[model samples]
Target: MATRAELTEIFGAEGVISLPRSEATAAGLSEDDARVLCDVGFPAELPVIFSLDVPGDPSAFSLVPVDTGADITKVLCLGGPSGNSEMRYCLDMEDGYVILLTLGRQPAAEIINSTVDAFVEFLYRYGLRLKHIASADDRQADEYTKQLRQYLAERDPQAFAEEDTWWNMIFDRLLGKEF
Candidate 1:
């Protein structure tokens, strides 16, 4: 298990950006749209925009699946108008893949957030850990960890309350290195 700081280092600063609603809409999606059309549920979508500039007109739905060798699953969703444009939102994990919804003017925020929630639920159902991400700065990492803890608490109060061991485990696996 890696600490939050370690995870942050591996993921890089780009990994911690808040998901942008404007980008989601620009990718033929609406504002505040969220749902899951693929493999599994995911964590809450934090606003993060990834720059994927290239040449020519490359417009298509791309799903990237990376195996992080963790108990949890992960996925990233990327789409845009041109080849040089960046991804509206990306979900990264080791568990499953993001769904490509080919529709007109979908809500990026809703879609991204809902899909992530679904995946997070999926991980909990399987008693698995969710993908861990962190910020490079210590203060940022601490804030992110606190937010994650709050999210976990709100999502699974009982599970969170009953386990001192799980907290230690999660802390170790998600934000351990910094401590």
Candidate 2:
């Protein structure tokens, strides 16, 4: 997991906000997850990934019950659904894996990344989609994509390969586009 300092360094101080310890605890966040949430907050809009809910919303954080009708505790809700959609991003508290939950979908939860840090890294690298593609700015999108690819290749080669494949599949599903 990346430290707060590391995240701030990569994303800049303006993009990150540290929540109070009490707020994080009240959110039912684990020590590890809380550290990330409290120390390195996410961006306001995360298109094709998720938009963060307001911090300190008691209802926004908790352990999510399994969707199988059988009672089982598995994932922890990190924030509310993005926009009006039922899809929410969560964390597998036990393993610290980032997951996506579609409330009305057959498969309730899908693993997105290996850790919270990795998920944040993904956002940092690819979040330009929110500004460019969301606005249909093809020229800016192309430039951002080129920069993202170059960044990933230089920073983490393995993640560069995996993230390309993962984001393609995830974005397709999120946009409801058949490929």
Candidate 3:
């Protein structure tokens, strides 16, 4: 997992946006703000990829590289702010659709619903299609999951305190338990 600092360095600090809880909650549009801010934060005219986890409601996130044309305006951080109440990290991507790595101590159903909402909102605003590519065919999911787990394991020293320690601690973290 790449820290916000690392992501900022890779994609340029200006390209990375840290969504804090206060700002998100005060707006009563944490979800919407998260996505839009994330999109706006990503540096324009550059191909970039970033990863981070939200240690709150969702356990992990995966950002897949998308064909956002040659002109990707910005990458969106669609997930809610982390519960740490401190420095929070978001993401950066190529375009079209980016993967998210969210990790939190919440019910599986809630997380899935929230993710679906985020993805739907993004599509609705951008007029994009919701495509489902199989993970078996794409190794990106596996690689992302592994990296996410390693990241959380370091932050969350409880030894996978999310849900299914093993599953959440691995690639399945991105697929969500209900999936």
Better of 1 and 2 by lDDT: 2
Ordered by lDDT, highest first, the candidates read 2, 1, 3
Task: Please give the range of 10 consecutive residues that has the lowest summed lDDT in model 3.
Answer: 123-132
- Top candidate when judged by TM-score against the true structure: 2
Question: 1-179, model 1: which lDDT tens digit per residue?
Answer: 22223323434444322334444444433222222322221222222212233232222233333333553332345433133242333444322222322233542221222334433342332222223332246666665666766765565454354434334344444565532
- Compute each candidate's TM-score over C-alphas: 0.27, 0.61, 0.26
51-133 per-residue lDDT for model 2 (tens digits): 56633322344566664476565666665445635666777776777776666636566666667767766675555445456
> How many pairs collide in each candidate, listed in order?
33, 0, 20
Strongest candidate by lDDT: 2
Candidate rank order under TM-score: 2, 1, 3
- Give the range of the ten consecutive residues with the poorest summed lDDT in model 1: 37-46
Instruction: Supply candidate 3's per-residue lDDT for 60.
Output: 27
